[model samples]
Target chain A: MATTPDLTKHRKMHRGSRAGIARRGHTVAFGQFGLQALERCWMTTRQIEAARQTITRTMKRRGKLWIRIFPQKSYTKKPLEVRMGKGKAGIEDWVAVIRPANMLFEVDGVPEVVAKAGMRLAAAKLPIRTRFVVRGRA
Target chain B: MKSVALEAFPRAAAKRNAVKKLRAGGRVPGVLYGREGSPRAVEVDQKALETLVHHATSETVLVDLSLQGASHLALLQEVQHHPISGSFLHVDLHAVRADEKVTVSVPVEAVGEPVGVKTGGGVLEHVMFKLKVRALPKDLPEIIHVDVTGLEVDKSIHIGEIQPAAGVEILGNPGFAVFSVAIPKAEEAKPTEAVAVEGAAPVEGGEAGAAGAKAEAGKAEGAADAKKADGKKAPEAKAKGK
Candidate 1:
């Protein structure tokens, strides 16, 4: 129920392997502290929602939370025992394509210690390894 | 040095959720303060603010802020953005006077291709992208241009070598290198005579024995030279690779 905005109307997408990230988006959005992905992986919408819920629950909604990524790409799967090459499988779930060095979440208006603890808890729900990062002084 | 006129209104409340309401209403929360006056909370039109910031040539922006029926000179200090949407979240402006000097970071740009890189098959490396400078608000430049056209292989341009505009002074160590022309890795990584000598040395060791060892040791100097050359070449490749 945490995941909303039904996107099932879209057609099935090709399952392309992970590609390396070429650039980090605009530097302005980087917050004081955040979680960075260390490897390429598909983050499901349910997983993102679960991680978000865990952070907000831990923080008690006292601070600002920014989900740096969105689950826009859809992953498809075939039914069990189905014959191959008939057609593409139906859409299974939505996912966000995460690459190494991409920031997953950012927290601000909160103390650094609390943000780190909350991000660590959120990281536990992710499929890929993550590292905590702080914005460097420019 | 160019001044931009901006209008802002005072924000009555300073709560965390107030920012959300302000954004929903198409306004951005900001603060204005510095040595010139007390800190004041203000808000500006989001579209106008985005245009001002987008067109700004440097991090330092001179704004003629019209607030409370008075105009004041200020500089754009810091801007915060929403991590996901990358939208403007907050802005901090520092009040300033035309006569006072302020220290700020200005972008450093290379104007031309280095002779070494163009002809000598070397790579141009930009060691530092921005330089800290001190100057009056009127004398601040949008960017500092360093001409690397004359730079040759193994030569570098240091901070001390740059001649800044009148009234502008660069900060930090003067000897720090801003840009350098380095030999490319492809040319440096090519196998040399020393490598061939080393490859052939071990094969002939059984017959020549001690003489081979002496010859190998003699060739060790050439290997060391090759290694030294490699050490110098690796960094340029790494820099370009990134």
Candidate 2:
């Protein structure tokens, strides 16, 4: 076998001066490979119910768990699933619903502002058994 | 400015194996630094990081991060994902004001089933996940909706379809293609000429007729199964990532 020179000294892209921010942990999770199993429980009762309804509708469409809400709203109000009769124009600001057990999850016009409140909502209101999934991209 | 009390710490020693092991336990290593704040290293839960990424638009989220019982307000600055397989590796959080106007990407969503889909056998496709926009700290969007119900197969839905909220402004080209309705891709199709060539063998000869027919039938069945499966798995992968 021909003796190959040690390539260890050959500079690779990962290490250099002013190096790209070091991977704090493993670069393992970056843009997750294959599929990422992420289950986010609704933190509040309203959030839980809303997420459940959303998922129900989403299941009818594409099954890819793709939902993005701008100006994400706070899940503080009661999620009204009841019809107000003949285009009553039931107004809504922010909402998300997911029923994983039944294979469903949905979100409508969620804003980013509620991202903070969502943490609280997730901690305070999500249903005991509710779950939602999304593709992981590191 | 409504400032959040976010905690700051120095980065942990950079070592591949150490990070993989730590993150496996849900502890993500993160860095924090920006105007008026010094840099530090910190560790946050893996689950918490994923939740924030999903719910928040970008590294633009305000984290009232607490470290060693001390808290400081910060913005989700940068999130690094693995190139081939998208996975969260390290997140960069920039401590900022609770009410500051920051620029970030907000997902642009299509609302209502497309007319192209209703009249045509088309499925809704989302081309953009987040649109870059500028807004106050409180005006970020988890996602934006664009209605495609009126569209036809020849027509398309673009970033122009997105309607910005008050105090929020979209930053991408208004004409960028968000999604469209078109014919679905056909797979595993054999040429007509090829079929004719094979068919001629059976009619032109008689002894191998039974075997040829069975082979052709099996190939058709396999193609049907493949189509059914293609639609099923793409969404599954998205679900797992989310």
Candidate 3:
């Protein structure tokens, strides 16, 4: 299973500045063959899990896989007919707030053709749109 | 500035599979582009090339490349590494004459802490990491060091201010800033509050007006506190007191 940390009892983080869309580290994380998101979207923990499973299964453990993003931001929701001003709703799930040009997954040690095919299958499990990218001359 | 001797063999085939085969055999495929001739495909031992690159102190390395019973002086131009594994993939070497001048980017390093950052509550910002310099192959310095100890707040070191080593000429706009000492963002936002209080004290008319002005200042302070609590336009609180 993909790693997920137990972040219970964590103090509520102050609503900080929005993640700048043009930041550097938001791009590709690891490996040469990867998928870059073209649109900003949120990837829930379960969705990321499904994508990870799809990629590893497709590759058949032949090469290395790197999940560049993590669902660290805690998301919350309120129940129906709830009154206003009750502090905050309990944490429901975790999500990664991904922006454009953010690399969602990467594969290495495999041929370019195999990595592309495997990443295509993984991209099907995600809600946001992504494009295949190859590490080339920068 | 140091020269390392390495042996390379001319690759028989220029096909993709042949390059992969060379890599699998613990060799890195490379190309040596000469000044007046077509590029030649060469393969160097992976371990030797990696060690030479790792030990080299500068971005530009003088390579005494031996290939097919002939040796040529070259400069290591570019290196490609596997994105994940950090292993050498391919390298580009450019043939150079020992007496000719070559332009290369040398890393700029700061040697001392600026007084503005150390005692004046300012921050030192390094604007340039690498500087382009043209010099003879023998006179190239590994790295350029800038002494920043004399820098004061609001002062900056420009490209024109730096003294390059003899026979080396820096290539860029002379006025382009290389490094600077500037007030920190948090400190830059602080002086307006003091200005507002000083501006208000002299404008009051009489004793009764002074009391009313004090009440207004207290109300403004309360509004500023409320704005801070709401986490919106906290900096505007200082502007509002004016």
Candidate 4:
């Protein structure tokens, strides 16, 4: 199933800044270990799904995965031969604006090695650089 | 709980720029207060503070702070760190007397392998990672260990069932769940099927589906227009990109 938001007030939105570090959702809140983003990027639903699938497959569904960021922002794209003066195009895709230090994924109920391996595999499917973080310390 | 000896010097500079200068000079500026007279600003070496934090087993650490000529037993209440670098920025130490009781959150550790996880292919979930407890400085524990050897599938251990250390009073809700063994996610019943079976009646007519689809389309268009009328609300993106 598509991982877009069920209901959005806005069909399309202007591209916002992705410069600063994440103020919140930066810690490994819900799990023993987490995959923290080291760079800012627009994380599409497909990338998130691909990373989630990779992690779940690597872990063999032994642990629980928490997706911290939701793709609430809608990005629109114009079709072929579209005029510049026309209104905003239909929503092409949904994306989550991720910043540095934002925790993208968290997994628990698995060993540290297994969780680390799963996060490493999942990070390969993402655009931003990521670091593996434990619960207590950064 | 082990009382680690840490040395602190009186911080003469209390201004914001001075604190920044102190941090630049490899010192973590901190405040010491509690059942004492006034809050004293002190600074500890950044390396020593980091070492103490790294080696500590739990968040709650008891330290014997030697300042000037007197020895003060203090609880490491809060330590702020730089978000990205994870470097220690500042610290707060609450001095405690031997007779006074202090409340702190202690980390909970699962001790043994659960039978449900071993035999029934269940996942062990650590529900409550930390427990709040009130105790004297000497009786305070660094971490609380709960044995889960006999825990079965779909069973949980509550806070009331676990035993506390001597002179330590567990402070939170007694019925709060600490740990549980749940069946694997794949085996869990699907929510859609459950809702269909229990809540909604079967829709046999195509008319109803067609009408619902039309209503949904109308709602979407109205929502889009309404959203456009008001300025587009972006997600909590603090930074402005060019």
Question: For every model in order, what is the number of clashing pairs?
Answer: 0, 86, 0, 1
Candidate 4 lDDT over B1-242, as tens digits, reads 77899999999989889998999999999999987689999999999988888899975799999999799999999998777799888899999987889999999999999999999888899999999999998999889999999999999999999999889999888898899999766424344443444443222122234335657998999899788755443432333432
Residue A128, candidate 3: alpha-carbon lDDT = 79
lDDT of 1 by residue, B4-107 (tens): 99999999868988778988899999999999568999999899898888888765688999998999998888887654345788889899889899998887
lDDT of 2 at B11: 49
What RMSD does each model have against the real structure? 21.6, 22.8, 18.9, 9.9
Q: Whose TM-score is greatest here?
A: 4
Assess candidate 1 and give its lDDT: 0.76
Of the candidates numbered 1 and 4, which has the greater TM-score value? 4
Label model 3 with its docking quality class.
Answer: incorrect
DockQ of candidate 1 relative to the true structure:
0.02
Query: What are the per-model DockQ values?
Result: 0.02, 0.05, 0.03, 0.29
The residue-by-residue lDDT of candidate 4 on A12-114, one tens digit each, is 7889888889999998888899999999999998899778867766676477888999898989898776578668888888999999999999999899999
Q: Which pairs in model 4 have colliding backbones?
A: A17-B241
TM-scores of chain A in all candidate models: 0.86, 0.20, 0.84, 0.94
TM-score of 1: 0.53
Worst 10 residues of 2 chain A by lDDT: A28-37
Name the best candidate (by DockQ): 4
- The DockQ ranking, best first, is 4, 2, 3, 1
- DockQ score of the complex predicted as candidate 3: 0.03
